[model samples]
Target: MGAARVTRRGFLLGGAALLALPGTALAATAPEIADCAAWGARPNSRVVNVVVQRPVKILVHHTATPNVTDLSRGAADALARGIQNFHMDRRGWLDSGQHFTISRGGFVLEGRHRSLEALRNGRKQVEGAHCTGQNLVSIGIENEGTYMDTEPTGVLWDRLREMCAYICGQYGIAPTEIYGHRDFKDTLCPGDVLYGMLPRLRGEVGGMLGQRLEGSSVRAASWPVLREDDRGPVVEAAQRLLRGAGRTEVAVDGTFSAAMAESVRVFQAEHATEEVNGIIGGESWPLLAAPVQAGDGGEAAEAVETLAATSSTRPPSRVGPEQWQQLLTAAR
Candidate 1:
């Protein structure tokens, strides 16, 4: 097989180019992927957007489907088709929301169009619809079953580890960059059990790629970093927190302006007392936001409900207390 002639900037086909992704020397082995056609995917409602940048992170999600006894290739194929239809028809997406999917049977299949090609090239990405605020920079992998309390099968776990190593190798991403869906959004996606297992997943993938995942944590949840120019519900959550903390000057708008940045830095100075970079990442989020439980009032409570209300297709308190606890745990 001819190696893709890939450069940091573009891909040239049918040349013996080095496939070692930028900033890494490890040779990535592309796994046997069942592309969209192989899984009998419906023609995309429209062309998938292929972005010209390597993804920096991997987001794991579960289909929230039943944990069935049947674990077969046929089931995997059916699952792929079902996902495409739901994303296209119901969610009104061009194709499946994720870049790839792993079935309970441990079959690895491509989800969105151009995703396999992008992976093979190792320097481009297909924009995903998986996480609202993070689709542009992350690759989403949907595991096949609901895993809130139950763990995935042994085969499923092994296959997921292999795929993560492959993706990390291909994209030159560190194992620490692997995160669960709930990290970025206010929803229970890659459920409790699977989310908790991410540290093990990162460690295993790092071992496979002969790489080190520095700064590893029990969960190492990657919250979307909010800078001055960033926008959306997470930013609003921060703003509301500031407003509630007596920064009456801060408005509960969904935009992260320069004033907000200064406010964040000031808050960090007063409370967090380190990494006063004015960015809401692992270092500052837990300090800025608090979890809201039943009948809770004040800005923290309002901010949690604001995130819930802002997220379409989820319940009123979809970004509920359980997920907030998980975030605080992982970030700390």
Candidate 2:
């Protein structure tokens, strides 16, 4: 859905009024930010209300642009405009795809209109277009510069930490929810150099907030090798994913039972992987978690169909084409 647009004049006026109110000033504890009006963003053709659900995670992305040294407000504004133009005019999105953007010089700007306002109230989030499946559930932050080779500047990193800590505080989200863009998608965004620093980022954010880090709550981006008897939330996650992929018998009891193993074997064989062992390792995790759609053939489609059939009370033969389509859409 498209985002509703706020005129530049209205946005600035609103900002001024908000600033005049108590608790609206950009405090020392909060990162200084530039609203969409500050970046000269055009009004969106369509604006949607902020979704009231609290964000579950923070997804980080890199702009994939050159690491320009200009850290001035003008430069940051220009960069924001460029990104918005690309998303709106080129990508055909209603507004900026991300909720926020940070420049190389450490200037943070609101990406989508009303994003800053939402954060200020700590009430809701502007639905972003950054990540496909996670747009409604997570906050997307795009960092300036390509980080495939070199690391982000010290200033940029520090600002990112502050921003993350502030966001976590505002949303009541945990630091462990921080994730690289590549963690959810196939792209090399937020680049290797930056992505490798996520663990440290999470730790620093946690430290900044004076919160003790909890290992159990963190979601592992990569699946560690899991053989029979391995059990935890990760195992449960795998079971849920497999069940969604069509293993109806695999209960999400967090146990790697024989039935779960057999399901894994069948999945591996269907995918034509070299190893057909019931164990779920690196090879099986990605396939299991990857999205499936209608018209998709091979093992993945079969798995999805199997799950759909089992989820329904009706027999497999009785399930119609529209029902299957609905199942596929829901699975995604």
Candidate 3:
């Protein structure tokens, strides 16, 4: 099919129906997604605000459930309701954690209440609960299936690429910003099989949108020693960690500025001794990147434990190694 055109009138309406052209064919703009109500979702009990800024990345997740073969719309709708019920009733979340759900049959349904409206506007994002530290700045898309053992169906994969391309074009996001959920979290979400497909997915999205593909979101096993004046996503990640750790002065923007240097110095002073320089070296990255479990004796973990021991009152007496690990991970 040809590229779908958007009329000025349609753009002004700002309705979910304006997401596509008058036919069932996919569009260059946002895909024709079924809203939560259309999928028989119950109304959210509380109010939700769309984040004023566009999301910096798109996080992909797999439902981690059985790969259901029923490809009917009713099945897809039921899947959406079940996920919403689980997230709300069991997980105690306000609504669905993900912003969108892609069915094995290629159906795309808005997961959260306001997610479709936000996407139609193309200037804001609905905050998601999919990733802990990334909830505010990342868009979450959950594909329905377990991908650890098998790959997604061809229909599901094609629709995902098209939806991602449309989202990227609308938000001015780079194709490289697409990432598996495990990139930022500790769990193996989006699974081994689907996560392996991210590169090809990114490439196809870039090709479709005629945009250049940049770097992937996966962090190297070992990060370079970052100091003042260093700048990039790594620095941004550090900044986010600092902010989460209660260093509110540091901005999470990608640039490593003077404020960031001071924040890093404060964190170093509180978490590690010996050297209080604002540099993030082998001693700091692990503590800031992810939780350090027991038997996880790296240089960074040792430094963290040592610092925790020195604290006179904070971290509470009841806090154990696992709790400490959680505190540090959330900070990162």
- Best candidate (score: lDDT): 1
Output the number of the TM-score-best candidate. Answer: 1
Please give the lDDT score at residue 61 for candidate 1: 92
Stretches > 4 Å off in candidate 1: 1-28, 214-218, 221-327, 330-332
Candidate 1 has its poorest 10 consecutive residues by lDDT at: 312-321
TM-score of model 3 (CA atoms): 0.62
Q: What's the count of clashing pairs in each model shown?
A: 0, 8, 0
With a 3 Å backbone cut-off (N, CA, C), the pairs that clash in candidate 2 are 3-46, 3-47, 4-46, 4-47, 4-48, 245-303, 246-303, 246-307
Q: What ordering of candidates by TM-score runs from best to worst?
A: 1, 3, 2
The ten-residue window of minimal lDDT in model 3 covers 15-24
Which pairs clash (backbone N, Cα, C closer than 3 Å) in model 3? none
What lDDT is reached at residue 91 by model 1? 85
**Candidate 1 backbone collisions, by pair:** none
- Candidate 2: where are CA atoms >4 Å away? 1-28, 214-332
- Alpha-carbon lDDT, every model: 0.75, 0.71, 0.70
Residue-wise C-alpha lDDT for candidate 2, range 38-106, written one tens digit per residue = 779989868755987778889899999999989888999999999999999998999999999999998
Cα lDDT over the full model 1: 0.75
By lDDT, highest first, what's the ranking?
1, 2, 3
